[model samples]
Target: MAGLERQLTLRFLAEPADVNFGGKVHGGAVMKWIDLAGYACAAGWSGKYCITAYAGGIRFVKPIHVGNIVEVTAKVIYTGRTSMHLGVDVKAGDPKDQDRHLTTHCVLVMVAVDDEGQPTEVPDWKPELPADIELRESAIRLMEMRKKIGAEMQAHVDLQPSLQVP
Candidate 1:
């Protein structure tokens, strides 16, 4: 249903503290903002506290300099039995300029939790609009890719001499 958007946009300035030695914001700091934005969106949608279950590959496309206006947008693109996949994008630009540079983009899965901190069921999200449908399809494709990558990584781990469980 195309109703209230389970989305959140956070705008802030990249302070010096957020910057690294190269005078650019650290990737981890941006990721934290992304996670927080996702959490806010997930909590609002599920009506329960949500935790980050997974954050997909995030590659920094451009460096965000200190004093730049940073904008992060997180929106629920797809939902499963208990999880929501949020597509988050980070952009930054000078206040005087109209251009907003795309810094990174990633898909995050947030799982709702109960009072006891256990995973709880969340409402399903049905895509109606064309953009929403496209996002949902992308989410499913990303999920499958993650599964395959996880399996491949696990297989490699199993071959490691020091990583054996037994």
Candidate 2:
């Protein structure tokens, strides 16, 4: 493969439709944007269709108001055999002011898929910058934590119900 394209940035205005009852852009709307940006970044890097396998550490740092310019940036930080780990950041600010602040951040794992919808190999990503290296390390650490969290969740699922339903 040629030099890998490792990042994708999407920019748009926060619309009134995205507002929640709290009068800020809804968290669900931000999540949808994160997924779309992550998928695009993964697909571009892998040169195949992709699906989101996991999203973690989603932090809502600030409320995004309608009419603010929103930017969602996804960077491919690490790659497994068939998975791409993306660091997605969402920011918004008044278009008139031309200043943006991070409103949300998360890590997402996307898997490339073949025409049959099976997992497919993705191009390897090498960290060329210090920031890239740090993000890659963070992804690896998150993967380790995911394993422990998964086990705990499975243990909970395996437990018998304490309360009987009518």
Candidate 3:
């Protein structure tokens, strides 16, 4: 997948506005960037509006400093009936050094929607390269883990009154 079309990369400079009181880029800002990149990848592949269904495995490896060059990459690793699983990576480094390192990583699930906001089927993506195949397998494992977590949470939802819907 050297020339894969189901991927999007967004590069920009980390500014003061993105920094938190601790002088590092806010985690919320990085998450927003991840969602934007994932949304672009999902919509580009499906040619339809996509909404983020789930975001998991988000790990902040390093702090992003202001004035660093930030790069966020999102790639579609697997596709289901109406959902696309994307791997999002955020990297940043000083502009002078130009050596970027991974600062954050996550997997996002996006669902394609029709004009009426109904979930719609997306075009199937077949992994052709070895790396792509491995990514697809990873996505499958993540999906299973997510399912288990969801089930466990659901089992305890009734025990927490604050979690119940009004």
Candidate 4:
């Protein structure tokens, strides 16, 4: 399925103690930003409430310290009956240094739900337009990664071989 793009920006000063430790931002804090940004992207596309089902390929490329404004951009790359794949890129630097380097990136899968809290269908995405090439590529890569992870997990489960009850 095809999806859309959404972005959110928060100045470094807005981040408080929850994200800072010894004047440096924590990894968990960075993850929170990813999730929030991804959610917004999914909601913007789905036009409804979306819940995070899974997040993968989370990599921390750099550390964000106190007083560094961070910008997070998220986009929906794929959509399904009730699920959407969102990609989030995080960067940090002084406002003056607009060249902000990428600090982290990840793909999150979210499912749209109705007010009754049940999964709901969303419009299918079509990437025939040239502008959607990037999003389409991202979704393809995410799908590939998900397949690999699923295979590894299955292998691990097979190795365990559950015991039968008496």
Query: Across residues 69-137, which tens digit of lDDT does each residue of candidate 4 receive?
Result: 788888766777898887788888886667788889888898999999999987677667676777878
Q: How much is the lDDT of residue 166 in candidate 2?
A: 85
lDDT of 1 by residue, 1-166 (tens): 2225688899999999998888889999999999999998888888888999999879899999989999999999999888999999999999788889899999999999999999988877888899999999999999999999999999999887884566
* Top candidate (TM-score): 2
Q: What's every prediction's RMSD, in angstroms? A: 2.7, 1.8, 3.1, 3.7
Task: Quote the positional error of residue 120 for candidate 3 in Å.
Answer: 0.8
Over 1-166, each residue of candidate 2 has an lDDT whose tens digit, in order, gives: 3227888999999999999999999999999999999988998899999999999999999999999999999999899999999999999999988789999999999999999999989888889789889989989999999999999999998895778778
Give candidate 3's TM-score.
Answer: 0.92
Off by over 4 Å in 3: 1-4, 161-166
Query: How far off is residue 51 in model 3, in Å?
Result: 0.1
- Native-referenced Cα lDDT, model 1: 0.90
| TM-score against native, each model | 0.92, 0.94, 0.92, 0.79
Candidate 4 steric clashes = 1
